[model samples]
Target: MSFRKTGAAILALVMAASLPVAAFAEEEKTIEPTEVTFWHGMSNTQEQVLTELTDRFNEENEYGITVKLVNQGNYGDLSTKLTASAVADELPDLAQAYNNWLTAYTDKIVPLDEFVENDFDDYEDLVEGYRAECEQLGFIGALPFNKSTYVYFYNKTMFDELGLEAPKTWEDMLAVGEKFMEEKEMPAFGVDDLAGFLEASLAQNECEYASDEGALFDNEAGLETLEYIMGLYNNGYARLIGEDDYFSSVISTQRIGGYIGSSTGVSYITADDFELGVAPLPTNKKAAANQAGTNIVMFAQDENQQAATWEYMKYLTSTEATTEWAMKTGYLPVRVSAFESDEYQSFMADDITATAAYSQVDAFFPAAMFEASNAVRTSVNTMFEEVVLDELEPEDALAEFVQIINEECDVE
Candidate 1:
């Protein structure tokens, strides 16, 4: 994929060759400066970095493009506001998006399939898994940004003292966790995001998470994955956030043997007392992890604003910008060049925990995204919790929630 071509490179040049050169070679029109409004949910340091980049682009880009950033609280708040704005036809020029969030309002958003195919050279530099959410739509609906994945972090010092090795597969995880549990009489393993863990596990085991007909997680393969997580919880081999707040906090305080959690979680873990270790998520029948993050999407607007928005969006995913974004924000870079850049390579050299996620980039894939996607995820989470807490039988819970989620997704 070529990234160097400017979006303004002879745009609107679809004249038939039969037309005389005199007709098509008229003087090129000068593009006026355009102000693009962008809505997002980033705050704190992330917001600071974004502001810094936007300010630089506004001041230095050859095209006079100004992007105004609007912080709309968190993602949930932004989603609700977007839907309302969609209804009122008052959407901003660009916004960050999850795959499912745009499915409901596709017409209002510009489909970038033609743009990327015709204008976005260097598309191949992007990680393939990042745009997978739009594969079903048959077009590039969004640009991947701030990508991350589930990673396994363990207490290496404790493992060595206990004569145990970090797990590489689900079977290893079960056996190792149970051995630690038996020895210490405490929970030995856990995951910070159960929903992401479940999704990645299903994919690893070749189970369909959802479809037009609804979820297939109650099937044999899906049940196997679900039960595996439940077994760890039921046998006291795994722990959940519950009343303890964050699992990362307990990782050092409670001395948990290991945990599967957000790839960016390394920054939050306190390693004062132990040698912390990080590794990619353990595999099962398949080696995979859930790719997590939002993508930037442009809403339909006037030609000038659209062009300016494209420049800003392109700048965000460029190799240099994405590499800097990842290093500062702890998110994965969107471009292969960014990932392999000297700056990023140096950062990865000093950070083993980040390597845990980056090493498995090839195995990363986003979960199925469609209408009511988050609803289905919540259903799966509830079902898992019910079974683990002994509030319902696994069979009953799975059967019930699968149907309920299907109805919520309007699958019939």
Candidate 2:
């Protein structure tokens, strides 16, 4: 069967079994609607697409559920506000939350396993890796929302002009950047998130930043990762997009020949003067890319509101909806069914750049999922700045940062 036809068949079966026929028929007689509030960090184009999808769900779903989406600026701001709301007992019915952020409110969030098993027959269709990442403390704490993986975004025109192939490993990446520096007199690579870059690089070297035991990135592999990145910075072959935006460094300045960034950022990367190319991040001991993005968490609400929220959540992650989302934004589809859908295939055919993230899905892994994950990321980022910008020696900087993170993070 065709991908679309298969999805449609499974969806029909799942929806038929989602709610009891007698209960659904009786509920249809109710005149009142269940009002659910959703707080999200989406803005600009992403927010627009989400609003359209949510509106469609509100209108088409069998249940009378009205979702009021409140924009919470960026993810960091949303995290802060959500934490405060949880304390005040004023949390929204649904919110976009990372695993670390969700860990802080375990008591206030509803586990999704019960709803998934009872209400959705196609729950097994969710991508296995995504499902595993969402699982916490024996229950699915959240559902994947706007997931993404890192990819190498390069200026194809520059590479073609120099007769250089895209880098496939860390050593090759530096060599390519050095060649670009010598030939074009500009840095060849820039990274928007140093922390994420470090995580992927460390994974390639079989190292973890931290675990329940403590910090694990202060060893040989970590030192090598730092030294190589700092070498590029010292040689004027690379730059870090600290406070400044990635687009400004790459597009506006035209100085950065390529960058390692989230695939979702593809829409923001403009190459009016050059051909843009997207590839999986370079590997070393192993192929690895950092998996990221928010998940939908349902708060502790009344039974009716909880059911309504689950319906919307399941709808958001449905094959049709996820395919539309991946096509509209450059984010990865959360379900395997979406990947197999004809709609996604057509969209990928038109612009393969957006699908670069999918190519790395099998190799993608999450960072530390504990509450201290954010602190570890901050420490690593600061360590990068100290080594590259402040000229701190790699070994000394790594040691100092590891100590700081261990003290601050209090792992286990």
Task: Find the candidate with the highest TM-score and give its number.
Answer: 1
List residue ranges in candidate 2 displaced over 4 A: 1-32, 247-249, 410-412
* Candidate 2, residue 140: lDDT: 86
Best by lDDT: 2
**Deviating ranges (above 4 Å) for candidate 1:** 1-30, 134-136, 391-401, 407-412
lDDT of each: 0.80, 0.81
Q: Report residue 256 deviation for candidate 1 (angstroms).
A: 2.5
**TM-score, candidate number 2:** 0.87
> How much lDDT does candidate 2 score?
0.81
In candidate 2, what are the lDDT values of residues 1-412, reduced to their tens digit? Answer: 6999999999999888866865786755332378899999998889999999999998997778889999998988999999999899999999998878866778888888888887774877876667777885458888989998778888889899999888988898889988998899978888878877777777888878776556788788888876776677888778767567664356444667888877887777667888888888888888888887888989947887887888889889989899899888778898888988888887887775656777777787876666577677777788777777776666776777678678767753
RMSD of each: 7.8, 9.8
Ten consecutive residues with minimal summed lDDT in candidate 1?
1-10
Q: Candidate 1 residues 180-237, lDDT tens each?
A: 8878776778877776777788888988777666877878887788677766787788
